[model samples]
Target: GGLSNLLFKCALPEHILSVGDEPRQVLLRVYGAILQVSASGAGIPPDWQPPPRPAAPEQLQGSGLCRHLPPGPGLAAAPRLLRPQGVDSLVLESVMFAILAERALGPRLYGVFPQGRLEQYIPSRRLRTEDLRDPDISKEIAVKMSRFHGMVMPFNKEPKWLFGTMEWYLKQILELTFPEEEQLKKFNHLKTYNLQEEMKSLRELLESTPSPVVFCHNDVQEGNILLLAGHEASSSDKLMLIDFEYSSYNYRGFDIGNHFCEWVYNYTHDSWPFFKASAENYPSRQQQLHFIRHYLSEDSGRRGDTTHEEQARIEEEMLTEINRFALASHFFWGLWSILQAKISTIKFGYL
Candidate 1:
């Protein structure tokens, strides 16, 4: 049998899999699983017949509930999981975010399995760094992020401090064992700069900043934003945010700042274990204003209709806040990279 037939036989349940059926396209591979996604109207082979639809699960069978429950919107074509190994803890966080953000911001959750999850396969392309450089696209993203931050999701946990989390990760990196030569090379710079002192300073600066605490995507690199098809230049829903593994309630400015900082790193090359960071490529003051203005105005529902003086004041405050929190974003990712350097096998620069 072919690869598709084999995947169908091994991954799908007996009631759902039919002999000789082709599997869907592999949408993504991450954290030891492949996301096999199918479109709703894809044509099946002429000789193939689908298996009978199974009865609703037992939980949905009680109290005439099945009758009132609306039919799922083509969830049968939802993405399936192909995990040859156990799920990672970070993958569980992805599952948690998908479940919590369903119909709110992120992708819809179709089902969860011991090995992985089934999700609604959004037809989209991962955004490029240049796409984010477009003024209209940047504004739309700001507005969408503002709307997301404003929502009161059902999560009940206390807001975690962004700086505190960075410190925790840094501590973990300190505790890990490393080869003598590797330790000498990586630790020499830290010893010279007194990393503990720098971290303390960062903590103080972020704590002193007056940013509002809101639910944040935490990681907002270009790769996480998907550009959907058939959108006009100004459409708000053109870009969708994905990958919520590091999402949490934190200072709102941190999200915006992290995204801005992400512009510096280019991960497209085949160069082994290294990424290019050009300081000159960072967004300029005008660009930052362009993004921050949209974020602030949208959150306020003004959308640039404010008086010139009012707009200026808002821009000034936002610029100050974002600049300060950008430091926190840098520190957070810097520590995360250190930890990834020790454990991750992916050929990306972690230092």
Candidate 2:
């Protein structure tokens, strides 16, 4: 049962007691906490003075979370709320950015406010200068983030499990593949998922290799990367990843592939903003080619165990894998939206 009207008293040198009512009944820990009953049925009187919440981030005026709680339930809703509704999400994201900083002495990610929606306030230090641009720094950050993905820490209230079984996998595959045409089929929700050798191939894949599932940030878009102060000043100003609301447990290759797709699409189809024209910050295409060639070589450490047969098939079939997985992701998201719509009786588009 959620605490109906629980009052938690803060028991620190600086007395702060938290009052929260949630959908679950459980004790929580803050710097120091206390539990009490608020004066029953009492509401704040009009004559009583209470502090006003911040109206704007600028108005927050750089006063840190330690001094004030950030305004709105935006961040609280962020780790789960998805699909845009006007400027609401974008605006909230802007506010969140204002509050977050990095730690120098630890794992290095620090939001200005670590209590309430963020987490317990830990002893945090300032952001350092060397942890951003260096290849070693990038790798370190990527690795740490990978661990979090592997943990697949559910942001929503529910504990998550990757799609239940091979049957589920087969169903999704069948839903995407085409029976009437060898080429990709336009999806029809009412139509049955085409069943063919594709289903067999998928079933074989699931049975043949049982990979350890890890959390993947499926939408690893450019906007999700939070870059610190530029490196020109010799500040490492590393990339801190945000927007994990779209995480799933799946093959890590998809995570890399998703990133690759965005990078490739942006560079090839969009513009030079990604590269500084001289390939300074993020490499130009040629530099990217060199990096992939030299850095991804067998001795370069990018290798994961791939069977010679799988490698051979990969050249023949890797593209198929990408399309298949992407199609699956689409179905997953679409089905997810439909379910959410049905369950909540809320309007949501399916596609």
Leading candidate by TM-score: 1
lDDT (Cα, 0-100) at 188 in candidate 1? 56
Which runs of model 1 end up more than 4 angstroms from their true locations? Answer: 1-101, 180-184, 232-234, 302-307
lDDT of 2 by residue, 1-351 (tens): 011111121122223333463111111212111011111212212222212212222222222222222212111111122222222323333343333322221122213222222322222222222223345444434454444444423323231322332233334334343333422233444334543454456546534442334556665545445444443434443445554434545654445444434433232113322221222333344433332232223222334666768655543343444434443444444444322222221122222
Worst 10 residues of 2 by lDDT: 30-39
CA RMSD of each candidate after superposition:
12.9, 15.1
* Top-scoring candidate (lDDT): 1
lDDT of 2 at 320: 40
